[model samples]
Target: MDLNDLHGIGAGWWSRILAGFHRDAGLEPTLLELGLILAVALAVSVPRASWRYFGLFVTMVHELGHAFAALTTGRLVKGIHLRFDQSGAMMSRGSGRAGAAWTGFWGYPVPAVVGCILVLAAFSGWSSLALSVSALLLLATLLFIRNAQGAVIAVGLALASSLLVWFAPAALLGHLTLALGIGLLVGSVRDWLNLLGVHTRRRHQLANSDAHILARRTGVPSALWLAGFAAVITACWVHAGMAVAAVAGFPA
Candidate 1:
């Protein structure tokens, strides 16, 4: 079959399957979404071994967010851990509510912005240079940011997407972007659900373990910080002129 025919079949199958699951378990739709994301991730990652480096870049971004939060609030970074398998930073400053909120909010966007730039460049026919530049930025960001979860995800996503564009056919880029967008939407929903008190064992564990650390350092409640981060992220989408309603899963 032709590419267009294949795409139509794939999309139709996915849509029907997702719709059925969405009507059944409600939670099953999320699993479907996750599966789609994993498919896309693998599609982009399986061509080469260098793609694993993207994971390291992601770890850096995640840790960098933590480090930035510490420094912005006048806290000192005691040490940085940039392990090939894991990445994070240690800081000595007490976290204030505003500082932590802003740090968390900005962490993901920074790397996402970089990714978008590289994607744009590659699409504009600057593939070689863009790939090289993006790789460098990813490595540098990973090295610099001490504790940035969002940054790590962003970098990893970018790296995977970049590699796909480099080695894969141009036809796949649109599909990859769609997959990434869906993944982000799922993530946004997951975050919102956590904020809404839907308790899972993992959620409870995270709350029990990290809650005190956050509370002791940043006098702000976690809910409020999450709200602030959501607000900032929403505002960013608004400024980008995309339909904020779509992002929020509301009618535009």
Candidate 2:
């Protein structure tokens, strides 16, 4: 056997993972590639079967939003619980009402926020660093996972990111990052629309919604909270849309 194999991730792998940070991933996608990215994004987000799995990832991101936001206000994030049914909760302690509201408001719009960041990374040629950071965050999230399913999801994502960072071509990662970011952006919209549907058609599930929970907790109107989510998501979408338009050579 080779000595490099004995060392596992040899020097070459490290170089691949770090190379994009030094050099650009290159502004390289054609219009057809942009369409392909959009199509892949829609494919994962639209079909019920695909959403069944992808939704869980989105839910994880949603819960992470709450977890990190709680941490932002000096609250202890006790744990995060995620389920296969695309539902999740973050348990935190020692937050006053303002802090509570601060954490509560982060869950819905954060995936979009992340999407924009990923898009910017790809465009800015830091896609490798983006994947590396994402992998680290996924592993870090495992520490907070309270359920077996959550642990499994976090581990899987972390492993996939790690593998991609090591083996996937750095240039291709830009395209991959664009695809993932747009897919997440689409997933964010899908989740918000589902939440809106919950309020409109299924009051039974209103208790499960962040908007309603915020309203009940703060006496503010749920519609306003919903609007807040909408506003953030729309802004991300528009920003991402312009980037996508540029990538596709279209007028923004």
User: What lDDT tens digits, residue by residue, belong to model 2 across residues 9-48?
Assistant: 5565556555645647445578787778779878987899
Task: Give TM per candidate.
Answer: 0.43, 0.91
TM-score leader: 2
**Index of the highest-lDDT prediction:** 2
- Stretches of candidate 1 off by over 4 Å are 1-64, 67-101, 104-134, 141-162, 170-175, 191-214, 233-252
Candidate 1 global lDDT: 0.44
lDDT of each: 0.44, 0.85
lDDT of 1 by residue, 1-252 (tens): 999999997575444323322111111123455466457645433333533454445445444555666677776666455555433444444556666544445443433333333333323344334433434445455444344553555456456634543455434433344343333333333334443452233555444323234544577666554555456445443442232223335455
